[model samples]
Target: LCYFQQGSQSHSVKHYWYTSWPDHKTPDSAQPLLQLMLDVEEDRVESPGRGPVIVHCSAGIGRTGCFIATAIGCQQLKEEGVVDALSIVCQLRVDR
Candidate 1:
């Protein structure tokens, strides 16, 4: 976690690191990563007016896109009772 201040504006930053997952391999189990995502969503919910959440890893969109697609799909499922994974993945490609 970190904090930055500039001329009366302040920002609180938090980071989540999952190091056990290898660079180019799928995780053995999704439990840990799912827990991490829940924690991040909880934090984002707690802070309503903060800036965007940043998700990244050592490389590129492989893990980044997976994490984001899952997060969004889960949210959509909870709120709408359905998960449009294809739509979400397609939007991810378009947005990227």
Candidate 2:
């Protein structure tokens, strides 16, 4: 994942990036995607922004949907009282 941050008055510009290999056949080659997410979160907290990332895949919907849903779940957990990622994901899927 890669995000381009257009700086706001409160925060500086930053590039938050992460990569993952989903091919199960090559598990050894699969790097830690969560670690990358953590780094991106740290960067984002250090520097907030307005612009969202341009996310896509070979077939963009499924991959993008999952990614965005997960982010929303985490955000909701922080902002709201949500505790279950799976339940949030279910609601998202139903709405979609």
Candidate 3:
């Protein structure tokens, strides 16, 4: 996956950091690398009038699905004071 910092005025990025995913289950196990990725994303978000983050995998399906689910769950949490994403996904699947 690639991490990028985008400028506000243009769609092109100002800076980027790239890394291969490590065989780690937890973010804590990949502290430095994970932090670097987060920092790049944060920088992009902080750019004035920046557009949405464009995260994509080659297939852009599996990871994209998870990210969309996570974002929806996060918004729901803020709105309804829920505490879990897994539970939300489970409930959504069940409700459907």
Candidate 4:
């Protein structure tokens, strides 16, 4: 984890690196990744005033998209008892 001031002095940034993830494929096990996402969510909840939680991969699109979709899907499953992966992907695609 690294923390530094953003452009403005009033705000700062915290970046967490998961170097274990491969460049072209998903991890063999999802537990650690899921835990990381949960940790990030917990941090967000604890710091409601903080900026957006930025998650990304080296290439910026493929793995980034997968991580985002998984996070959203997990949230949906927890809240609504179902995971609409297709909808999440579609929404992400539209947003992207």
Candidate number of the best lDDT: 1
Sort by lDDT, best first: 1, 4, 2, 3
lDDT of 1: 0.89
Return whichever of 1 and 2 wins on lDDT.
1
lDDT, candidate 3, 1-96, per-residue tens: 334456653345554433443223323344554454556557766886766665554465544444446556656766898767778678656744
- The model with the greater lDDT, 1 or 4, is 1
Taken over the whole model, the C-alpha lDDT of each candidate is 0.89, 0.57, 0.54, 0.84
The number of the candidate with the highest TM-score is 1
TM-score of candidate 4 to 2 decimals: 0.85
RMSD of each: 1.1, 5.9, 6.8, 2.2
Of the pair 3 and 4, which is ahead by TM-score?
Answer: 4
All candidates: TM-score: 0.92, 0.50, 0.42, 0.85
Error of 3 at 37 (Å): 9.7
Model 2 has an lDDT value of 0.57
Write model 4 residue lDDT over 1-96, tens digit each, in one string.
455665765555667787657888668888878888888889889889787889778889987888899889989999999998899999999999
List clashing residue pairs in candidate 2. Answer: none
| Candidate 1, 9-86: lDDT as tens digits | 998899888765788998998888889889999999998988899989777688888889989988998999999999
CA shift at 80, candidate 3, in angstroms?
Answer: 2.2
